[model samples]
Target: MLIGTPTEFGAALERRRRELSLTQDDVASAIGVNRRVIGELERGKGSVRIEIALAVAQAVGLDVDLSART
Candidate 1:
């Protein structure tokens, strides 16, 4: 999916997490982050650190690819 906004990223993460049958706590524990952080990221909180957000995506089996706009 082409995610252009924080909200889109968060929604994708949440959808993948659900598809994988993972709870927020499961992702948090795997990534060594607070559960609340997961919630915040899933809610599209713009303040979420990019590293941490990416970590959550990784934990949920999501990949972020960067490409130049055509």
Candidate 2:
């Protein structure tokens, strides 16, 4: 199953950030976004764009790429 959602990905991103000792502000700064964006994402608000989510994943060192070729 190919499962992808901003909320799920965002939660993963948050987990990775914490594992790396990074705060929401840290990720926001690295991704050029506001801390609220990170908070909203982590909470699964579901209004953020996919590109932004990818940016968050990258900034937080989370694996964002998909291996869709099955």
Query: How close is every model to the real structure, measured as TM-score?
Result: 0.97, 0.79
Q: Give a tens-digit lDDT track for model 2, residues 1-70.
A: 2336666666777778899999999888988889998899898878987778879877776664567566
Tens-digit lDDT track of model 1 for 1-70: 8998898899999999999999999999999989999999999999999999999988888888999999
Candidate 1 residue pairs that clash? none
TM-score of 1: 0.97
CA lDDT, every model vs. true structure: 0.93, 0.79
**Candidate 2 overall Cα lDDT vs. reference?**
0.79
Q: Highest TM-score among the candidates is held by which one? A: 1
Any idea what lDDT model 1 has? 0.93
Task: Score residue 22 of candidate 2 by CA lDDT.
Answer: 92
